[model samples]
Target: MQQPLAPWLEPTLNKLLAQAHEGQLAHALLLPLSKEQGAEVLLNRLLQGLLCLNGNACGQCKSCHLLAAGTHPDAYSIKADGNQIKVDQIRELTSALSKTAQQGGARVAIIWQAEQLNHAAANALLKTLEEPAANCFIVLASAKAGLLPATIRSRCQNVALTQVSKAQSRDWLQNQGVDWNTVGWTYDVLGGPYAMLQQQGQERLEQLQSARKEWSNALAKGQVSATLCQYTQDQPADSLHVLHWLISKKMGSILASQRAFANRLSALISEISQVRQQLAHMPSVNYVALCTRLVLDYQQAAKQ
Candidate 1:
């Protein structure tokens, strides 16, 4: 059985289903979501609802069964190839959309990480977006919708998925039999309930704890540790994010006499942000080197 939608996402799903039933659903929808949101779960429920023969995801109909089994011929998906969605992938999806639905019902297509669509891929999809086939719907999901082409954005109806509040998240986590006190810092660093849940295994928690200790020691000794470098090298983006959070927290506790040190910490945080941006756009960048440089800079900053 499929898991229920997160408390925060249920309303959005219901609204979309209502629109579909009223024949007011747009041909193209753009869903902008943050990393902590459960985009896949919401998308699965939306697809099942849209393709269900009964106009509701009853889960008893043949369409629902096929979707559950991942054999729904009318359902199609496009994903990034490595770091980009190429033109050929878009071409194939368009060709598939042009064909009749194998189940003689609505056809649905989902483009995951839509922001990763390359220039040519975005151009290739415009015709289909403007002239969708009868009973066809296209859904584009992206964390960075601003990276998508203006033409693509203009052609689609926007669907905003809001983040869950901290209080709501804490309540949900408690209901799941988790102790929020243990994972609260992880949640703060990750900034989402789902992200915290996904990343908060005992082993990961230990690694983060160890990294924090090493960071403090490095600051006092004015030298970065091998363990700290390894942690950053293993997951460069996440490590940098954690480091950024740590620096901000440390800055808050600095004495008024340490204003110069706080300023240095602020500069280090900005540098980490820039490195993170580079990693996101250029996956091939030497992350190991970047991690070393960031940790080294932090060590120097601590020397005041």
Candidate 2:
């Protein structure tokens, strides 16, 4: 059985359905979603609604069956080959979209992580975005929509998904049999209900909490602990996120009385962000040294 649409996503789905009902749905849609949101669930619901013969995603129709079986000729999904979506992938998509829908209904194409589309692939998709075929819909879903070229973003209708509130997320997690008290901090770090749930079972919450405590103790002692350094080395991305959160929290607490110290913390936070960006785009960058430098910087700020 298909899961129901997430409570937070229901409104967006309703709006899209209403648009489709009025034949006012755009040819291209840009969905900016974070990991915390139920992007996959929303995407599935949207596609089914568009492809369903009854216009309601009834799940009983032949079109729904084809979609469920992943054999729907008119529905196409594009994903990054590795870190990037190549020009060839976009070319193949355009070729398939040029043909009429085999099911004689709306043809839907979804590009997951559309921000990962390389320059050539993005360029190739421009013409299709500018002039789509009849009954064709292109959906570009990206966690970092700003990374996509302005030209591509300008051509598509931006659909902003509703962010789930902390109260709503806590209630939902509790309903799912999760112990909110134990996993609440995970939610704070991830800022997404779905992401928190995914990481909960993997014991990431415990690791992060431990790291936070260790870092706090080290900050108090005016030194970076070897264990904390090891943790950062092991999990560079998670460590950086935790570090950012910790420094931000510290900065906020001291912003009123310790302006100079807070300013230093703020600078360290900015440097951490730069290191994160460097690691993301340039994997060969020396993250270990960067992480150590950030920790030392945090210690210096704490001493002041």
Candidate 3:
């Protein structure tokens, strides 16, 4: 029989369970999950199972019931307020950890979008990380690890989760009662299950497809200013993906196209890399303006 969670969950949970079984689980862990993977749900189940008095998640004990009800006193969470995680939030979380475990079981702290932690917040978190409490576990979930501070990153055991194959995603969608035919743009835009659910349904998918087509066409025409303003309105997080795709396409065309644009492909690739690097620090920059400038710079580079 299929497990309660996604198939990919097995490899990750199994590794953790084995470690916990052998009493080797580290105090802190960093789970870098792909954009589409449901890290939150998986972590919940893992925590519930970990806290259950029984070896298995009987879902009957007080701990399991509290977890299912989302009232587990030992479980803590911190998420980005806007583009950044403030220092105050980190302080609050650390203070919460100082208190003894509510049920005298393992205490857990989960940080969502860990890459959003600013310098001060990250530093504050590092203090607790350097000296974790006994029987306490800290789980930081991130879409990408490079955005995090190197100091904080070095302390945690890193677990990377990649995108599930297209076939696996398609099958999962089918099981969720979604027809593959209806998944045209949603599937492509989301790249996996959680995103599919977030961006699902009829009207939204249509809008995404329309936005993508228009953006692609404008980008190809070297109309940078108009495209930038348009993207400012849509504000899709996949802008980096679009830039990379365009660069790849232009590079592939270099061998055959007599378009007479000398070193144009090379310039585009350079600009894309710079913009992508900048995107990782969005908390510190005016993101909309930066995106506009990136498009303008890319167009200027192409013309040269």
Candidate that scores best on lDDT: 2
Q: Write the per-residue lDDT of candidate 1 for residues 132-155, one digit (tens) a residue.
A: 888899999988899999999999
lDDT of 3 by residue, 13-107 (tens): 77786786577888889987565676765776668766776735678988878877889898888999888999999999999888898877778
**lDDT (0-100) at residue 296 of candidate 1?**
73
Candidate 3 positional error at 108, Å: 0.3
What candidate 2 gets wrong by more than 4 Å, as runs, is 1-4, 144-151, 223-226, 254-260, 281-292
TM-score of 3: 0.68
lDDT of 2 by residue, 76-109 (tens): 9999999999999999999999998998899999
Worst 10 residues of 2 by lDDT: 283-292
How many Å off is the CA of 14 in candidate 2?
0.6
- Ranking of models by TM-score: 1, 2, 3
Give per-residue lDDT, candidate 3, residue 203: 67
Candidate No. with top TM-score: 1
Q: After superposition, how far is residue 196 of candidate 1 from its true place, in Å?
A: 1.3
**Backbone clashes under 3 angstroms, per model:** 0, 1, 0
